[model samples]
Target: MGVVNVTPDSFSDGGEWFEPDAAVRHGLDVLAAGADLVDVGGESTRPGAERPSVEEELRRVVPVVRALAAEGAVVSVDTMRAEVARAAVEAGAAIVNDVSGGLADESMVPWVAHAGLAFVAMHWRGHSTSMQSRAVYDDVVADVCRELAERRDALLAAGIRQDLLVLDPGLGFAKTAEHNWALLAALPVLHGLGHPLLLGASRKTFLGRLGRHPGEPLRPPAERDVETTATSVLAAMAGLWCVRVHDVASTVRAIAVVEAAMEHAPEEGPA
Candidate 1:
């Protein structure tokens, strides 16, 4: 999966693709670079961000989704609104990637079920403005898995097909850097939930903070591709279903190598 933020305030590459033409071009670029899906989001979900008006979100996202899907790129609307998702589907989106996991909008789950679109249900605690305060957890991995399972059950109960649902741990949504790392290490445990997993650790703040000296500035989001690629490689090795990334080509190449290496590994256990 590749990320295409159509808003002016996403944590990374926001205004860079705010224009429909530019976003469409970017969508094509990522697809050519080997992304199986292009995720187009209008609203910024960065911590402390405010919600965009539904009208503004629809205006921002529908055209890009329409253009990208027309060009034959598989498109996922990264929205938490049923209205936007409905319009994007009408415009040609095949999947709805909701960060709120049907919790943000009351109408989201039923609408998704009615449309029969594939849904990426991320584990979310609250909206961006206050979500960070909700990061509390007894055990990050177990809590995330338990919450995700609750979401999965709710989504299924709302009429979404079990197979069409994909789980995302909401990597940086309400998580501290340590929490994100812990979840990364527990990818297999997340997979134990009986659903395919989507990992979106690409260029996130946690990756940006890695290895930085005390009092030094964190790595810029655009410069975190190296860490993003490494994490994507690890996630792939851990049986992740997909990785939402800003830099798709490099991760694609790395995963290809991983696949090739796995193909030729000896049958005996390493130990």
Candidate 2:
């Protein structure tokens, strides 16, 4: 998966592709760089961001989604609104990558099932506006697993096929840096939810923080790709089903190597 931010306020690469044309171009470039899917998001879920109105979100993503789908790219709408998800899927998006895990919108699950689109149910609490307050977790791993399991049940009840589902641990949605690292280490546990896992740790704040000194200014999002790729490699080796990334070419290379090494490893089964 390749990350394509159509919104102007995402924590990373926000304004870089804010323009529709630029976003489309970036989509094409990512596909050429070996991204199997292009995730187009209109909302900036950076902590404390305001939610864009439905109209604005639609305007930001629908055209881009349409163009990419027309170009034969597998597009995923990174939205939490049923209206936007429905519109984007109608516009050619094949997947709904809702960061909210069907919590943000009442109609998202049923709509996704109705359209038979692949749905990524990312763990989320409140919307970005107040999600910071909801970040507290006594046990981050258990809490995330519990929440994701709840969402999975909702999707199943809403008529979505279990096989059409994917789970994301909501890397930076409301998680602290430590929480994010914990999730990274425990990613395999998320796969135990019985859904394919989608890891979206690319260029996140945690990676940037890792690159900074204790008292120095934090590294910027754009500068965290190398560290982010390192995490992605680890995630792949840990059995994550797919990784959402911005620098798709490098991630593809990294994943290819990981897969090759895993393939050639001596069998570890019963002798």
Best by lDDT: 1
* Alpha-carbon RMSD, candidate 2: 1.2
User: Model 1, range 84-184, lDDT digits (tens) per residue?
Assistant: 99999999999999999999899999988987879999999999999999999999999999999988998899999988999999999899999999999
Backbone N/Cα/C clashes per model: 0, 0
Off by over 4 Å in 1: 268-271
Tens digits of lDDT, candidate 2, 154-219 = 789898888899999988888888999999888778777998999989898888887568988888
Report residue 124 deviation for candidate 1 (angstroms): 0.4
What lDDT score goes with residue 229 in model 2? 88
Per-model TM-score versus the true fold? 0.97, 0.97
